[model samples]
Target: MRVVRGREFVADRAWGAEDIASMNGVSTRLHWTDQPYKWHVNDGEEVFVVLDGKVEMFFRENGEEASVTLGVGDIFYASVGTEHVAHPVGEARILVVEKEGSV
Candidate 1:
């Protein structure tokens, strides 16, 4: 069992994470970041949940760039082959669930 206080969590580097759980090849992680993540596609589905702070989520759609601002408690679902990146408004804590070993 584990308990994490998102507001109190910190990372060694941008996008650094704490492995929360793994079940049936899927993994759950808590991440802290003040920088943007690289645009990339996940091998499978991804669930992004904002735990604290805010984020501007950018993605490519129909070859055009698009984005949405996510606040605490907002959720973003990225299916396979969805090219997207996350830019934190400042420092943010996020909970991510996806296939293990996925980039």
Candidate 2:
């Protein structure tokens, strides 16, 4: 068990993550970012939750690019084959849930 104060969380580097848990084949993690993440598609679905600060989420849908601003408590769901990336407004903390070893 662990306790993370999201408001006080500082990223080790851009898009850095702290492993939280892995059960069966799924994993949960906490991520901190001060920059934009690389665009990629996950092997499985992804659940992204903003824990602190703000974020600009971008995704590719039907060959078109779109984006949205996410605040604290906002959740983003990326289904399999969904190409997406995240841009933190500043320093932000996020929770990610997905299949183990997926990228």
The alpha-carbon lDDT assigned to residue 16 of candidate 2 equals 80
The prediction achieving the highest lDDT against the true structure is 1
lDDT of 1 by residue, 40-67 (tens): 9999999999999999999987799999
* Candidate 1 wrongly placed segments (more than 4 Å): none
lDDT of 1: 0.96
CA-lDDT, candidates in order: 0.96, 0.91
- lDDT for 12 in candidate 2 is 70
User: Which residue pairs in candidate 1 have backbone atoms (N, alpha carbon, C) closer than 3 angstroms, thus clashing?
Assistant: none
Q: Give the lDDT of residue 41 in candidate 2.
A: 97
- Candidate 2 segments exceeding 4 Å error: none
Clashing pairs in 2: none
Candidate 1 accuracy as TM-score: 0.97
TM-score of each: 0.97, 0.94
Lowest summed-lDDT stretch of 10 residues in model 1?
1-10
